[model samples]
Target: MAPLKTLLLVVVVLLPVANACQPPRTLHVPVFHRDALFPPPPSAKRGSLLRQRLAADAARYASLVDATGRLHSPVFSGIPFESGEYFALVGVGTPSTKAMLVIDTGSDLVWLQCSPCRHCYAQKGQVFDPRRSSTYRRVPCSSPQCRALRFPGCDSGGSGGGCRYMVAYGDGSSSTGDLATDKLAFANYTYINNVTLGCGRDNEGLFDSAAGLLGVGRGKISISTQVAPAYGNVFEYCLGDRTSRSTHSSYLVFGRTPELTSTAFTALLSNPRRPSLYYVDMAGFSVGGERVTGFSNASLALDPATGRGGVVVDSGTAISRFARDAYAALRDAFDARAHAAGMRKLAGEYSVFDACYDLRGRPAASAPPIVLHFAGGADMALPPENYFLPMDGGRRRASSYRCLGFEAADDGLSVIGNVQQQGFRVVFDVEKERIGFAPNGCTS
Candidate 1:
């Protein structure tokens, strides 16, 4: 009996030391495609889902390329939340209220619909009421978080002189409310205190039924930046196949992971004029072992002065887009190779894809492989499904048609959208200023 008592005392003392020596564990939040949130009715047509997604992708790309309508905030400008692709569930306030938020990498500012709304859009579940949370507090106008706003506002009531914010999106969606801090909790019970966010009183847009938007852009006010101190200045995401709907889920990871060790890294470029977007140096491209002609590295170079003529990696846009001339070259090369492989081309454009193939009788394996070459010899060899998106042929077969998943931009600014990034673990190490990619990372 005395020996057992001594052993118990030893364990009680050693447990604290063991826990103290343990390293920080990474937090993984499940991410779902927007389609998974509100699935189409059973009566919906076969090709309707793909068509709707393509249309939304076009709107998102247009918003990114427009670069107009810059708001008072450094984080605002052409952020079309209506066309956002993925979303995640988050908990707000002290009691932890669940809210579904769109996961966007194009803009900054984490905001959500709050109670006592003047004009709020329809959202699922209950709206976050700060009054119910003990930890909720409105930020003062003189606070550092308020001053961080590019253009801060003071309320008309001026009762307590609290800081206010107004953000406008390219698609006419706007959110106006008080800047406040509260406890933010994730699904794994990982919570952060004193996190600054917008409690939108008046909000409206094509947000579908989401509670709000979660921005992971490069701005200082971005969620990624706000949590950087505790989680490290690193974040990563692995987008699963959207067609699978809710059956499979990838993670939006915060902090370091074992997968980073094997990833191929490239220098993350930045444009001082437009600092919120992630830019990269693209060397060129290849189609079936043949180098594409016409466009050079100089063509894809970023003009720092104007913040134009560069490539951006975005998770909101569904399909990748290149400069008009560069895209023409890539399309022609891909078409030539596809034709040589005995694939028949369909006339006219299918949504945003121009080079579509009639895959009624053809196997998906026959499609040529496409590779994107970035700086530092980091090449992303895309699988057939990554570059070729299959569509439903209605009453016939779902895989009867497949289209090239790349598009041409009106301007020189090219975008690498989510379609090309599926199945790869894309790491944004902001502190190190480098982006890393590891193939087949979703399985982990």
Candidate 2:
């Protein structure tokens, strides 16, 4: 017979081994609206807020256009973006420096303003200081990690050579500094140690008070890639409806998700040049179940040699953008439908959106539902609210403006904007190279 003392010793010895082999806990970061930014902005009127966001969107898209170009040309090492609607709170470093950074699906590098900044932007929360972090380490140019970067140039060469990167956006914003490895912790307290990221020193941009950006793009150097093993290379976010006044809890969850029955899927196309962006084989689009012809060129094709066509799922940009011909066709169709339904067309262009309707005397512009028919039969249907913005934002005529939330791209590219992504759970399955769309996807 085994004694009680012998049993206790065996159990104690096995416990440590079991814990070591166990996977880290799943990270759940609550993604809230940018309006909750710390230090806050000067309270502006609703109209002013809308205009500000629109202007920021233009700047961000311009940067994205330039980023894709830079990727093919190999002229730049880093790209910086200015604005985003959702910001995630992540704790980085050994002691942990909580940073409020914009969540961007377009760019690949997770960067933040660091200390000893010769130049810096006005950031709200505490600026992350690498020196304060016990686990901080810089990736040298000669190392494999440094070589993996899109733009890797070593200011200090060797095994310990510091990998320095310089990224300039099309909008005149830039971030330049060292590529480093640090402990990246999420709100869950669990963390991935020695995660690679950009520690920005000299930087200039219109980023309002937020520390930096959290890059969740499709690239080897992206934050998502670095943390892949911990979560099986998967991440999904459920964006709340921005039109709602009462803020509900929305979130970004790491690791695998249950196969949602209502979810639709489309394969992610291959793009060697600008692989960071999520490219889907978008077959066509339809308004009121009627397909608009002659705008086929507007749908960007997934071709490596061309590097021109194809669309990306961008969470950074607010409105959707399609190639010129496609945008024109879409606008014409929407306007025709709205006019037929008794929506008074406003004169001239309202910002970047062309289909501005006077919803003063009319009920909310109930344009027919638009559906995005992706490759492999995944149809993503968007309500009228996804493509149109109510100036007043309520039934009781609060403001006299309503504009289409879609835009025309300078290049023949298409972007599924956040507005169109509202009230749905958009899943980026990087491992399988496919995207999933579930109706009314929400996360806490």
Candidate 3:
């Protein structure tokens, strides 16, 4: 991957602001609740605490700020994976071993493909062995959670308890295995031990880069919910990129806030309509100082049965996608800006920005300014460099193309990926009904 060019310049001026009014009577955010499938086993709480201490020490050694002045939180990068996906390494079994897994907030379970096969692509860390873990147990297939996993054509009549099942991703990736317990380590902090996770006997199209996923959702059994009982119901991560300055110290704040100086941005409590999940009130979206009217209200709803929300905040996604009209408006604005720069719009595989030019031509002397306006009157101005990706078609020429793409998903919801989220402090408050954003120094 080419070095990420800093393209957006943000100047955050601290402002004194009053907190939004709190609604009377705390709202009961309906979350999918499940009884522990397996009995709680004895754990070394002191050992867990000791692990946390080691994590703090590790963080001190890894923490560093880049020249741009933005704090580079510790992160583990360069784990191998296919393009356009997210993955992480995780520990499983009596003695924790590492496995590469997808880090999916859209998912509720942190599972791994496990077996005796030596050819299984694995990260350079410990491997999870379910047979050796005494606490490992499975939920019955008849259980509600397992039944939910059953697809439209999948047969529910299975002998396995809720502990064993299979799951398929939209990208055609699938993992089949028994649900079992294992230890999980985050930033050296052993937050949960003998936690329920997938022990897969087989997986197809699984990325070998990540050990396992860290499911950060609101489901009762998800990493967010399981650790909430211990960590104060929150986890934070800064996406990794070539420009990232920190190392394997990337953080996962479980049951506690990652240490940072509080800014003037008011951390609104999440709306109670969504339970066990982070839903932020998105006031609206803007571009170039003008508000795009008729966007969907930021209020989100969580489906307690599935432990998923109607709308979610995902940083791993590379662009900020909106519902139909919002997406069209943003695209149209960008197209207009590109046309103004004298580029002729073209339609082709390498064509982007609704405009294109032959690589042999002189590049435009100037590009128009592209800015995004957010709720609470914050404006993020992005330069042309931020929106374009450098492409080398078969010809020996260099051409810059916009990195924007819009599509309506089968799930009928919009996604804001890393492209739009670049250089912003995204706060996900599960307790509050709103997502908050502030500008960061991401541009040169």
Candidate 4:
């Protein structure tokens, strides 16, 4: 017994020394959600075609609630249209709803033209009423968040405190109302309760069918920032395209993910132009497995006057647009590959690439990979889907054609939209200067 006791004492003493000699363990961050965070699947009967379309639209509007819990980029229809901008909707509050509301980012409030409006649009969902909800509380005008909205000069003079304000968009869309809180439910595991939002009146634009604009951009009062202080400052979202309605979804991850660090794609810090915004380093664009040149050393240009870098990674735009030189090189390479495939040149100077043909009616598997080269000699290989879609332009309207086009932009930056950024897990880290891309697909 005495010998055993002495041996245990020696083991305990050596344990601390052994731990001290070992290197510190690195902290692991998670990339994807292991469990659903929002409400369980709704048992309501399948919605009508209209209802299905609205739900589909909502999924397409990808948003990121930040560390502050403010929402950014309320995507609509998979297109990243400006928020706080006003648009008309057919239905708003009624079963056959139609109404107009301003889409905003800087403001969390989402309200519609209601009660006694001469030309009000209809809405599909129940209108939010502060008086009806016991949890509703108007924000005081004196709050810093309210003051930020004062800049665009759209404030409509209300009792200001907590989370409320009238806001406008760059396109002259405006809304007036008291700011309040509400619940935001995403199809994924994201349930944001007590989220600051706008409740407005007298909205315009009566053709839009959406319930209202979701304020998901980076702003002081946006959904992500406002909720972060209370609910761990993290939000996630998934966006789906029109074609893959049921199975397709994309996510917007706030803060950091433990699973991303191990990805093969290198992560680079975003440029510090918009302090709140994040961007990923685009490596390069490729055609048919061949690496296109000239974009290797591309540096995002910062507009000193605007304090924002024009380069953007958008999942909304349908095509990849670039400056003149970059566009010419990419277009030419694709045309060359098409000509080699025995495709006749069209009157519009379009060449068909044989590589675009496959027994499956898709690009052949043997076709070269369309690679995008990055600054560090890194490359992102895009699948055929990234470049070709059902061709719609020219006299060949209904006829199927596969080709690429480039549009010149005044801004000296390249845009990598959803059409091009497919097949990779793009992680946007706003706090850090890095955007990480992993060679994985949402399907995988």
Cα lDDT over the full model 1? 0.72
Could you tell me the TM-score of candidate 2? 0.86
Q: Write the per-residue lDDT of candidate 3 for residues 158-253, one digit (tens) a residue.
A: 544344656554323456677655555433333245465666666654344444555565555565555443334444443333223333322233
Per-residue error at 271 for model 4, in Å? 5.9
Q: What would the per-residue lDDT of candidate 4 be over residues 1-444, giving only the tens digit for each residue?
A: 000000001111211010111211221112211111111134422222223323322222222212222223333322122111222222221122333332222233344433343333454445544454444455455644445453322335634325344443322334555555444432232333444455655444322334465443344554444433332233332232323323234444443445544343444434333333434455557677667775423444435554433345544333455555666666667767766765444445232222222222334343335676555555666665555543423343224444443343333544555545545666543344344456554533
- Per-residue CA lDDT of model 1 for 301-342, tens digit only, reads 899878778988888776788887788889999999989988
Candidate with best lDDT: 1
Residue 106 of model 3 has an lDDT of 41
Candidate 4 lDDT at 202 equals 49
Q: Return the candidate ranking by TM-score, descending.
A: 1, 2, 3, 4
Give Cα distance to truth, residue 65, candidate 4, Å: 23
Q: What are the lDDT figures for the candidates, one per model?
A: 0.72, 0.68, 0.40, 0.39
The parts of candidate 2 lying over 4 Å away from their true place are: 1-25, 38-43, 71-84, 156-160, 243-248, 392-400
Alpha-carbon TM-score of each model against the true structure: 0.88, 0.86, 0.62, 0.62
Given candidate 1, what's the lDDT at residue 216?
84
- lDDT at position 283, candidate 2: 81
Q: Give the TM-score of candidate 3.
A: 0.62
Error at 396, model 2, angstroms:
13
Total clashing pairs for each candidate: 0, 6, 49, 87
